[model samples]
Target: MAFREYKIGTRMFGIALGGSMMITLYMPSLTIYSVGVTETGLVKGLSYGHNSGFSYEDPFLQGKGKPLTVTIKKDPVTGADIDPVDAYVYVPGTPFPSAVRNPGILGTEVAALSADDGQVGVATSDEGAVFLVSRGDYEGETFPYIENASATRDWTAAAVLASAADTDKRHVGSGKTMFVREGCEVSYAAS
Candidate 1:
């Protein structure tokens, strides 16, 4: 007894069946979030008990155990990256917790950052945080949390988990397949 109204500009195109027009529509959304630093020249690895590494895991997609292919945006956003220093908090006034934990996405999340090029992966988890302050001197001093982090200083990205269907490949019978293709560029955070 309840009907949902489609928004204007909504693409409703599909095959005609049973003397009636059958239309299918898919709505996909992308989220970009940022890991901002409050102070300049702040030490990168303060939360993870280190001074030289950064890493995080998406809690939502832990069990899937699939790696996501991340690509940084060609043009970095302004104020997207920040320099690290030894401070009580990365964001001014927001004191660092005794321990920092990675808060992952709700539906699907990133598991880990790949060693090469820093692409994220998905995996299994009982209750771990999605993002985490990494360990080691290489990532801590060399890498920024966001893409082109050192240059841009800010890291923002779209959630890229391979577990999600990147493309639509549904077969509705009748020698025809129905699917919705989704595309997104890897950024630092969800907006």
Candidate 2:
């Protein structure tokens, strides 16, 4: 329910989601694909050891997988994009951000609920922390445990193993845990 500026060594022991949360992503360099035509977008490979890289799998899509088509939003609330072809997170609907262990929304949960409104600040390149996902209520989401880690640091053996475990339980349709982390992103997508 609170937003903190992600720094290296920021403790993300348990967030709403147990995988990578969205970090601040610049729209121009990033690329994101929309899910089901306008519902939401997923970042590829965001699960670190689990997802396909910056992209995350949507648990509600009948099966587990991320979006396949690139999308950009023109709505001012989502932000303005110089290039229409790019999946720009700064623009509110862009995608393909830097892959980290437990990806957290780029900023506060409210920003996340609406989309990464760049509340923290704009990035020249992909920057910030990856909030770890845990199966507890974090701003109202649930799943695995992903630690907020440094962008440059490599994942520890334990972290990687933990991520794999979370991925397994998270993608299941019944619980729909991934939504804990993705709830806001999906909400923004719907807008």
Candidate 3:
């Protein structure tokens, strides 16, 4: 088996939590390949199995000897680059679940989305609990959903989401945000 690896170094600038901040992300992964890699950007590596893997977005298929660089823009609302509070990277040949989003289906829970359109959803066990999803790409950024303030509980879920209503639940895209309220049970899934 041929071992192909990719290393990505990224720098971000924007406003987060009402302050200017800069962040850097180091990402590396290995894959089994014969040749060729093209697309390059920050992606949530998904679709992992023995001898192969896939990303939510198309993986850069450029051949070896290429350097991948990415620049994260500022949040539209806050006008500052969001911080990647819970970014993660894989070691090339790791086993992971798919990051695709299916409506009303349960998926693996991750800290953040690695690629754009990485599917994510929320579930709640508590009654009257609601989650708000922000409409934006939240990959390489940190947007935590506060479960309880009095008890001081936090979840590494997505950020800046639309409110998930008791009657209607929806899936959010990668780099988005979510907030839970009213003691509702909330869980996230990715394809």
Best by TM-score: 2
Predicted candidate 3 versus true structure: per-residue lDDT over 81-102, tens digit per residue: 5543222212222222222122
Judging by lDDT against the true structure, name the best candidate: 2
Off by over 4 Å in 2: 1-60, 66-130, 133-153, 156-168, 172-191
lDDT string for model 1 (1-191, tens) is 66766543243322233224212222122222233332221122222221111124223422122112222222233423334311111221212222233323211111122222322222112221122233222434433321112212233222212111332111111111111012222221221
Per-model root-mean-square deviation over C-alphas? 21.6, 22.7, 21.6
Please report how far candidate 1 places residue 191 from its true position, in Å.
Answer: 23
In candidate 1, stretches whose alpha carbon ends up further than 4 angstroms from where it belongs are: 1-67, 78-152, 159-191
Candidate 3 Cα outliers beyond 4 Å, as residue runs: 1-73, 84-97, 101-191
Clashes of 3: 42
How far residue 148's Cα lies from its native spot in candidate 3, in Å, is 21
Reference-based lDDT, residue 173, model 3:
21
Q: What is the lDDT of residue 27 in candidate 3?
A: 21
**Clash count list over all predictions:** 40, 31, 42
Candidates 1 and 3: which is better by lDDT? 1
Locate the minimum summed-lDDT window of 10 residues in model 2. 33-42
